[model samples]
Target: LSKQTKDPRKKVRMLALAHFFEGKSRYQIAEYLKVSRTSVNKWVKDYLDYGLEGLEELPRSGRPCKLDDAQLKQLKAYVLDSIDRTEGGRLTLEDIQQYISESFHIEYELSAVHRLLKRQNFSWISSRSI
Candidate 1:
């Protein structure tokens, strides 16, 4: 972190602090480096309170998935199946939505069905296979 840091003073500060922790006498370090002992002590305390990762940081709560594993499995079954006899030989996004809405009572958009199907390796396919 000190090597990559833009500020040369920060590297010097960190190095002096690490030397103190490794049993170098503060007065000896200060005399050799020509700096005050107080600055070395402060940097040591700051590094101990917060690890290096905490010094420069980001915050993220990540995106929530649309479907869980079980819903995903059921959705995959619907998508890859040759026919939905439950809705007749014909199937559409509306049929998928209605089935989900009726059974689980979870209303979702029709396009969402297309996305879910695609995520499960289904595609807009030739019906000659049907």
Candidate 2:
């Protein structure tokens, strides 16, 4: 199961518990797994407290996205539709940033705009140019 699992962290947790079941000490498990003893302890504690579900990653509460799903879809559609309207049929980061600020009333820096584009699978490299 650990080998088949995609999440590397979860795989480590499973291996730690496997070592625990084998009657290995926390120190032995930590050394074998190459993870900190504290991490091994936490994993064991979480497993004991909540069973298999605890082995899964908890939802992280990070900074919320400026554009929600619908808005993001709208932005993507606008970008695709506006391609022909752009200069040289290419949309620059500045163009996207300006559109987001004017249309969505949310100003994003160029770096943030680049990240957004990357998340949306919009590559800077043009297919035709490739």
What candidate 2 gets wrong by more than 4 Å, as runs, is 2-6, 77-95, 114-130
| lDDT by candidate, in order shown | 0.67, 0.88
Residue 40's lDDT in candidate 2: 97
User: Residue 10, candidate 2: how far off, in angstroms?
Assistant: 2.0
TM-score of 1: 0.41
Q: What is the lDDT of candidate 2?
A: 0.88
Candidate 2 C-alpha lDDT tens digits along 24-69 = 9999999998989999999999999999889999989977789989
Worst window of 10 by summed lDDT in candidate 1:
51-60
| Strongest candidate by lDDT | 2
